[model samples]
Target chain A: MSSFAPVLHSEWLKIRSVRSQCLALAAVLVSTTAFSVLMCATLSAEDTSEAGFDPVRASFFGLNFGQIAAICFGSLAVAGEYRNGAVLVSLTAVPRRGLFYTAKLTVVGLLALAVGLLTSATCFVLGQAALGDLGVGIGEPGALRSVVGCGVYLALITLFAAGLAAVLRSAPAVMGFLIPFLLMLSFVLGDVSEGGGWVDFLPDRAGQQILLQNPDGPLNPWTGTGVLVLWVAAALWVGGRRLMRRDA
Target chain B: MTSIDVTQLTKEYGGRRAVDGLTFTVRPGKVTGFLGPNGAGKSTTMRLVLGLDRPTSGTATIGGRPYAEIDEPLRHVGALLDAQAAVGSRTGRDHLRILAATARIPARRVDDVLEQAGIASAADRRIKTYSLGMRQRLGIAAALLGDPEVVMLDEPSNGLDPEGIIWIRRHVRQLAAEGRAVLVSSHLMSETASFADHLVVLGKGRLLADTGMREFIEEWTTPRVRLRTTDDVRLSAVLAEKGFHPVADDDGRWTVEGARVEDIGPLTAEAGIPILELAGEEPSLEHAYLALTAGEAEYTAPRPTAAVQEV
Candidate 1:
């Protein structure tokens, strides 16, 4: 166990010191946080008379980018060995495939959660402040839940993307397959799809459940989250099985 | 105790057999040069021993356990398959750190190995900025992180300069001196002559010869004696009288294969043949290897000029 700790620490160093994960996470936070502020500031004063704007949902719109970064990090973890033919070196060091896989997943998961939570909180606060007359405050009935939920949404979506990338084990293949799938769900699945009843089952739609400040969204917050978690678990199960059974 | 035991180890890629029935013990305190051509399965065999690749047929073990079964492999056996295999963006120290961490070695081991491989001063620099020799040193540092008993290096001197080549040779020799089983592979036979105590010569995916240095040298070398005498006619007559075959050259010299040096010198003097240049020629290890792997010499090192006479 202690031996594995250095491996984990090294993985952390690679993640933080390297360009990919840091840059991608930064992009996600900056884009999403900026978008939330811009959207809230543009909201007209008349909008407040009708209903409050969802500050949490507005804060998390950049999760779409954050999710991509998760996939990149995860895919690189497993597939980097293949690209360089260094898989031999890795397996030689830590022969247990399951342990190796677990360490990678743990590192990616922890980092994604930390960055997602930070980004979500920052986006929520900035967006709420910018809303002025039209914005929903944390004191509002569902505002805090929505704000926190946005963070969970970011983490879950990122993990799910990562698991998918791991299973595929090819960067181009995962990117090519997942990006369109994400785009389809966020854009195409949102329209002409029976008020997103089916779309709500996809990871992107289900993850969005936590961002509803009105507390009147189609799926209840927990159930929608469950749907997202189920998708992530299922993806991980498939990915983990593939990795376990195949030769590294 | 067996330094390394490989039993009927075999590896198949798709339909091709990479290592076919490769079974040999690598004893400690001696270098066993694994000689083979490109794509001749040297790396594949090493990979199987390290448990990086599963053998299709047999087992390869060290200390009575497969490599993958070892608790701390880097400490048990160190290998350098490729120096540049680790990511290039990380610094040299960082790359060693990750490997050292996995092996459960002390953090100081990273610096220790860096120093051992003589690259500690450049530890803080990024790997991408490293020269080829620097990367090779980093790779060796990673391998030595565990301070294992067995060290396997694949072409550690592949792209190195003459000085770097000598450096690797000295290090490898030192590793063996410490009673480690060092298996170094190369396609060149000349590299093995001095480096290997035991030689395993391979050609076109099959074992051509496996023997000790002295025995191989003796067996491969054909015996010949070169004699230069002023009285070529008298020597030829003495040779004909004794029924010995004498092949005279343009230099008024006779070359004999059966006569001993003691016999040749005295016989020439007794026969009234004043000798000028008299020397015995024996075959070298390179000659033996070329003769054994006749058609399989993929790339023989060009003979250097001012060649030493085989006397």
Candidate 2:
């Protein structure tokens, strides 16, 4: 087998070389932090002190928007190969379908993790500043967890989209299906079922639990994130099988 | 030297055979022209050989190993299946650099191939902004980056200008001269005739002919004799009586099919016919290709008269 380091390096070069992909990565940070600040600025101190209010969750409100850019970044990394027949060239170089798919997803996951960490930290710091006196400190119970969980959440969502993109083989198709499912379907299911039952297992709804201070869902914060991880593993498994069996 | 060996290779898509039990060898130190009409499986065969597509049966090997089994196959075989295969959002240089990195080729080799392909000036430009000709050059540059033993190019001259076409011919020849196995696929017979030392022709996903370039043309077409005699009337009657079907032209020249120059010269001398001009015409590669692939075209236009009548 070829060395994994070179394949990883090559996949990284592929992502870094494309301007649109870099822009998408930047959008992840900008959208998440900007939205978090906006939400934090508009909230009142009285609301923060409310009986059921969760300031840690409130700080990550921008994650909803930032995940979209993260999704784009992930999908573009994989689907870009299908576009313009780039996959053929990629497969030609690597030859081993498994190796190519693993290296590509590894690069996407790592980049998303790095960017997700930066975005989460920025959103937390700026979001607390915007909240002023109502803000929670990092040392506060569940505050650090939310900040770190927010990064992991973004990376998982990105990989989820990437895995789907590999199966669909088109960025637009992956985006069209994932964005609506993340923004509306999961929330609608949660609202209709009153945040209980099977809807709690839905990827976005379940994963977002880590950012919350209160435990309302049946699954805890870690368990909820584990549910999302299962979804990601499933997606990656199906995507890898498709890549191995299909023609480039 | 590494060479491609395809034996009984077959690929079927949804019960439709794209490549049907095709077998051929591409040896080193020669340019083998892969000729076929559209949808005749030229690209499919190349894909299978490169391991882009899984063959339904049999095997395609480079140097006795499957393409997928070879470590860093780009260092063994370089291929240009499509000129537009590179991501358009990246610069030309970045595209080659990515491939070079994957194959562990030196970074400087990327610039070397760019200059060799004659696209160094536009290496920094986004590939989306490049013209078709420039994209072709970039694709060629990517193929040569690894400097592999076997080179496979499918329709490499598709969008090239006349100069670019000539350059590709010379470049292909040079690769073969350096003892690399070069298989160039094209639908244009004349283009293949210009540089190929061997020929592999396909018809309807089946091997139609596999032989040397000269032998293939000679085997498919019969030689003809053309004579312009001083006594046209007597010469024509004598040739007809001797069981030769001579096609007379308005320019006073007669053409006889399946007749050699020596055969005609002896007959004319015995008849005391004064010949102004008598010469043997070599069979054309275009004619041989057309004849071999006559009914094998997957998509052919209807005749003009037939279309007019139907309308």
Candidate 3:
């Protein structure tokens, strides 16, 4: 078996070598921060004090747009392998399919996490500044958890899309399915169903709960993130099995 | 010297056998030419050997272990199955760097292979901009990066120009001279004849011939005598009476199969058949390959009318 470290290094090189992947990473930071600050600046003090308004969630509004770039980063990193048959070269070099898959996800997950944390923290600070007197402090109740959880959420969603990309083996297909399911289908399903019920358990919906200061659903922030983790685990498992059983 | 040994390997896709009970060994210090028409399972066999695809039955091993079982398999065996199998957006140098990092190969080796492959000037360019010939050279550079004991290249000459072709022929020979086992597949019999010491011929996913290059041509092709006679009809009749089947060329020359020049010359002289020219024709590798794979080709184009009479 090949050692894990060198494989990790190689996977890292693969991700950074491509211009689109790097740009996607930058997009995650820029789009999320820019949109979050914009939302904070436009909101009035009247809305911040409202009982139903979640200031933390409002501050992280850019995540809605930023996650799309995160999805692109994850999917392109894996799906690019299938684009020109690079997977064949990859598998031949490693030969151990499990190790290769793990290393790849590890690199992608870590990179996304690093960028996610930076973006999350930056968006929070800037967004609060834009909100002026209405803004909440980082030390306030649930404020710290929301910020950290927001980063973890982005990382999880990135891995979630990457795992699906592995199974789908096409960038367009993965993006086509994931973008609608996260952006529209989950919302549509939530609106149609009363009391949230099982609809609250959807990966993106549950995961986004980590960004909310006051939880409306039955699940807490950590547990909501747990639901997304379960979804990610399932995707990665199926993707790994397919990679092993199928010929490159 | 490590060698590749395949035993009764078989691979079937959707109940159709792509490689059927194939067996061959590539020994060190020789270039083995893998010859077959398209869809003859050459690529499939190479894939199985490299562990890119699983064989349905039997085994393909390098240095006494399966490819996956060997730690750092690239250090033991290097293979290039497809030249175009790369991310087009990555520069050629970055592409090789990724592989080198995987195998723990030194970084300098990437530059070394780039220079060796004659693509160093274009090493930093995206592969999408590369010509097919340049891509082929990049592929070869990657295969040699490990400097393994065994090297397998499939259709290495596919997109090469005449100079590239000549360069690869010499490079392949040099690899064999260095005592490494090399297996190169090509449908061009002429190209194979130029570099390969041994031949492994496949037809419709079955092993048709596996022998030394000279022995293969000698065994599959028959000797023939070509003669231009002043009296073509009389010479044809005399050859027919002697139990020799003669074919007449459009050039008015007569060819007799399985006949020696020594025997034909004296026989026609004694029979008083006036012959303007008589000589023995050396059997070509193309003829031998065509004869061996005559009916086994899955795809064949119809012969043109103008060329039919030359046979």
lDDT of 2: 0.90
- Tell me each candidate's RMSD, in Å, in order: 6.3, 3.7, 4.9
Ranking by DockQ: 2, 3, 1
The Cα RMSD of model 2 versus the native structure comes to 3.7
Per-prediction TM-score, chain B alone: 0.85, 0.90, 0.84
The list of candidate 2 runs beyond 4 A from truth reads B233-247, B262-274, B294-311
TM, chain A, every candidate: 0.88, 0.97, 0.97
Top candidate (TM-score): 2
Q: How close to the true structure is residue B277 of candidate 3, measured as C-alpha lDDT?
A: 91
- Candidate 1 residue runs with Cα over 4 Å from true position: A45-53, A214-219, B234-272, B295-311
Tell me the tens digit of each residue's lDDT in model 2 across A1-248. 44688889899999999988899999999998998899999997677778998877887898889999988998999999999899999999998888888899889998899999998889889988888888878998888888889899999999999999999989999999999988888767766888499888889988988898887889889999999999999999999999998888
> Which digits, one per residue and each the tens of the lDDT, describe model 3 over residues B1-311?
88889999999999999999999999999999999989999999999998999999989999888898878767778788889999999999999999998889999999999999899999999999999999999999999989989999999988988999998999999999999999999999889999999999888688898999999989888999999988888898889999999999999888899998987998999999888999998888899998877755434435676588876
lDDT string for model 2 (B79-191, tens) is 99999888998999899888988878999999999999999999999999999999889888988988899999999999999999999999999999999999999999899
Candidate 2 chain A: worst-modelled 10 consecutive residues by lDDT? A186-195
Q: lDDT of each prediction vs. the true structure?
A: 0.74, 0.90, 0.91
Interface quality of candidate 3 as DockQ: 0.75
Best by DockQ: 2
Better of 2 and 3 by TM-score: 2
